[model samples]
Target: MKGLYLALAALLVAVNCEAKEPPTQVVYRFDDHRSLELKGWDCDGELWYTDTQKGIHSQVWSQFYRIFTKKFIHPSERYMAISSWGGGFTVSKDYGKTWSGAHYSPGENEPNGDNRPPYDDILSFTVVGDQGFLQTKHRLYMSSKPFDDPRILPGGPGIHYELEDGVKGDIQSGSAGWAWGLIYMTRQGLKGTIQELQTSWKDLPDKTPEVKGYTGWDHMRCDMDLGK
Candidate 1:
C-alpha cells in the first residue's frame, strides 16, 4: 500500500509539471543565423527573434494573440512585418533592429461598416508585397504602407472563405481563424493602393480574383532550442 501511494504521488507531480509547461512553435526561419519563435499558448505569449549574425536574441512583442496573429518576413529585402489582432501592424525595416507598432484600442469598438454589425473578431490577416489586409466578419481593413501603418487602404466588405473542411468556426463557435490567401474578390473590386494586385485584377481572365500567396508562412518555421 505504501509503495502504491508513493508511485501515485510521483505520477501526479510529473503530470502537473507537464501541464504547466508553455507551448511553443517555430513560426519563421530566415536562414541559418536568423529565426522567430512564439512562446506560450493562445493569446498569452511572447514573440521572440534571433539573429545570430546580428548578435540579437530577444522578445520583440508580448501578450499577443498567437492563434490570430502572424509575422511576415522578406529576408532578401531585410523586411519583417506582423499583423496583430489589436488592430494594427508591427514592422521591422532593418531585420529586427527596429520596429514600428500600430494598433487600435482593444477596449474600443472596432472600425465598423455601414449597416454592419460591430467588428469584434479577426477572420483573416495577410501582407503581400507592401500591402497588408485584415478581414473581420463584416469589414475588410487594409494598409497599403503596412511598414508605417495598417490602415492605409479604404475599408469595405470582409472576405468570406470556407475552411479546409468547409466550416468557418472560431472562438465564438469553436472554429479557428488560420492564415488565408489573398483574394481580390470583394465589393471594392480591383481598386486598391497595391499596384501589383490592381494591375493583376485588370487582366484577370475571369471575374473571380486569382488567389495568391496562400502558403506565405510555409518557410517561416518556429523551433525552440533553449541552449545549455
Candidate 2:
C-alpha cells in the first residue's frame, strides 16, 4: 500500500508539471501599426501588445490556434479583424468584448449570378473604414459594407494570376485603407499594387522593383507602416 501511494503521488506530480508548461507564443504585425503577440494553450488564449506597454488580455474565442493574419482600419483596438488558417473570417468591434460570426460558407446563390461557393482559401482579411477585403488563393473578394454583400473585385483575379500562362502566385493584402492593396510574385518579378474602394487598380512603381535572380517567392511581408 505504501508503494502504491508513492507511485500515485509521482504520477500526480508529473501531471502537474505538464500542466504548468508554457503556451505557444506567436507574434503578428499588422499594417495599422499594431503588433499583437498571442499566447495559446489549448482552448485558452491571450493577446499582448508588442509595441506598447499594455498587459496581456484574454479572448473568449477558443479557436485561435492558427490565425494567419489580422488587419484594422485604425490604430485603436476597436474593430479588430482576423482570418483563420481554416479559411474563416471574424471581426470584433468592441476590443473583442463580442464578436461577429465567423464566416465560413459562401451562402446561397445570388440573384442573376452563378452559384459559387464561399472562398475556402482565405489568405488574408482586412477592413478599411466601411469596406472589407478578403484575399483567397485565386481571387479577391470585396464588400462595400462591412462583411456583407461580397462581390469579386474587377481585375482582381488577374492581379495574383499571371496573364501569360494563367498560373497563380502568392498574393496577399498588406495595409488597410480606402486605397489598400496587394503584393504578388510572378515570373517577371515581384510587384505591388493598390486598389481604391470601388475604384480601379493602380501599380506602385517603387515597391519591390526588382527580384533579380529569384525564380519564385512566398510569405511576403511589409513593415508596420506598410513599407512606408
Q: Please give each candidate's TM-score.
A: 0.43, 0.41
The runs of at least 3 residues in candidate 1 whose Cα sits more than 4 Å from the true structure, single-residue gaps closed, are 1-24, 30-34, 41-44, 69-79, 84-87, 104-124, 128-131, 135-140, 144-228
Candidate 1: Cα lDDT at 196: 23
Q: Write the per-residue lDDT of candidate 2 for residues 1-228, one digit (tens) a residue.
A: 999999999999889866774454434544333454555554224444332333425453454444443332223255455544444445565554555544422322223342222444445444444334554454445432333112233333323434445654533343222221221212112213222222233232222122233221122222232111
Of the candidates shown, which would achieve the greatest TM-score relative to the real structure?
A: 1
For each candidate, what is the lDDT?
0.46, 0.39
TM-score of 1: 0.43
